[model samples]
Target: MTGVLAGALGLVVGLVIGTLGGGGGVLAVPALVYALGQDARTATTGSIVIVGIISAAGVLARLRGRTIDWRTGVGFGVVGVPTAWAGSLVNRAVPQPVLLLSFAALTLLIAVLMLVRGSSSARRTDGAGPSPGTPDGGSGVPAAGGGTSGATAVLEAPTRRRATVRRVAKIAGAGSVVGFLTGFLGVGGGFLVVPALTMLMGLSMPAAIGTSLLVLTFNSISSMGARIGHLDLDWAVIGPFAAVAVLGALGGKLVADRMSGAALNRAFAGLLVAVGLFVGVQSLLAL
Candidate 1:
């Protein structure tokens, strides 16, 4: 019975990660603790293993689709490595209830942000046509006979430069936060990664999902390395759990291909809220 439950939970976790490019860690940790009777620390350590493998599978599944932004994903991962290690150090010192509560709060906050971003994106899509610009929606170059002057061109160049710098800073900041959360909470941090890719880097939903998986894979590796000496391996549970999760991840990729970006965001947001609430309540009771 326990084995059956573990497989079912693992499938759910993989499906969430595969389809949404994140939230596997969020679901996996709780399932391990409550369903499989593991403690918080063990569950979190195991979550890193499960989420990492499945994320790698997800990245491969999307590779042929050409939806991943590898450059951005690699850059994000690079920035996150040190921070993830730091977060793991802190994770060992925190109490279980505090850790769980913190995870719940962060989860809820990200869900709200996702919903807001989704609504804003929908509004922009519905109410406005694409701006006059390059094929990729960049600002148009001034025509020779147009009323554009050298002075205006000079001013626009600096403005565009500053905007680019700001976007880069935002990406770096978001990556650090996601990495810290991944190590500290034993989560894939995809809930945050997808939004960062879409809102900051301007990737489409599919691209963001694929790239998010890559980022998760990197963060998971960094986090797991930090736990090498601290955690005891529970292969009995983690082994079978991860196997079924890989299969579910493949199925999830197919589901994601058919869904709209807005629908995916909405669904992801709803799931976060539900899980966050449950985790929050449970943590408070334990405290």
Candidate 2:
């Protein structure tokens, strides 16, 4: 009965990871603790293992589509490694209730952010004006007045350079935060990664999803490695869970391809809200 339950939960986690490019850890950790009878800390360790493997499988599933931005994903992952280790150290010191409460709060925060972003994107889509950065409002044609003056062109060059620098800095900062969360919570940090990649880095939905999986894979592995000596896994439960999740991930990828990005974002945000509320309520009652 426990084995069957684990498999069912694992499939759900994988589908979320594959379809949304995140949320697996958010689901996995809670399921491990509440359903499978694992302690909070052990559940986190197990979550890292499950999410990391599923993320790798997700990456492979998207490989043929060329939706991933390898350079960005690898750079983000590299920035996160040190912080992930640091977070693991902190994780060991925090009490279980505090950790779970923090996780619940963070999940709620991310859901709010996603909803805000989705609404903003919808507004932009409805507007008639060109996209913010485009000159002719996304018409692919130059403005009717022709090119800018020589002085304007000269100024724009430096502005573009500055923008690039700022973008790189933002990526590094976001990556560090994600890494820390991954280690501290035993989550893949995909809930945060997908938004960061799309909003900050300007990747399209498919690209962001694919790239998020790659980042999750890195964060999960890094966190898991830091917990190596302390980990006490129940392979009997995790083994079948992980195997079923891989198959679910493959199915999720197909579903994502057929859905609109806006719809996916809204759906993902709703799920987060529901889970966050449940987790938060349960934690408060326990306290």
lDDT of 1 by residue, 1-287 (tens): 77778888899998999899998888998899888989888898999999999999998888788888898898889889989999999999999988889889988998998899899888887987657656666557776667777767788899999998887787789889889988898887888899889888889888999999999999999999898889776887898899999999999998999999889889889989998999999988887
> Stretches of candidate 1 above 4 Å error?
129-141, 144-160
Worst 10 residues of 2 by lDDT: 139-148
lDDT (Cα, tens digit) per residue for candidate 2, span 1-287: 88999999999998988899999899998999999999889999999899999999999888788889998899889999999988988999999999999999999998999899889888977986766778666745444467655656687799999998997898899999999999999888898898889888989888889999999999988998899899899998999889899988989999999988888888888888988998899999999
The candidate that achieves the highest lDDT relative to the unseen native structure: 2
Output the TM-score of candidate 2: 0.93
TM-score of every prediction relative to native: 0.91, 0.93
lDDT of each: 0.89, 0.90
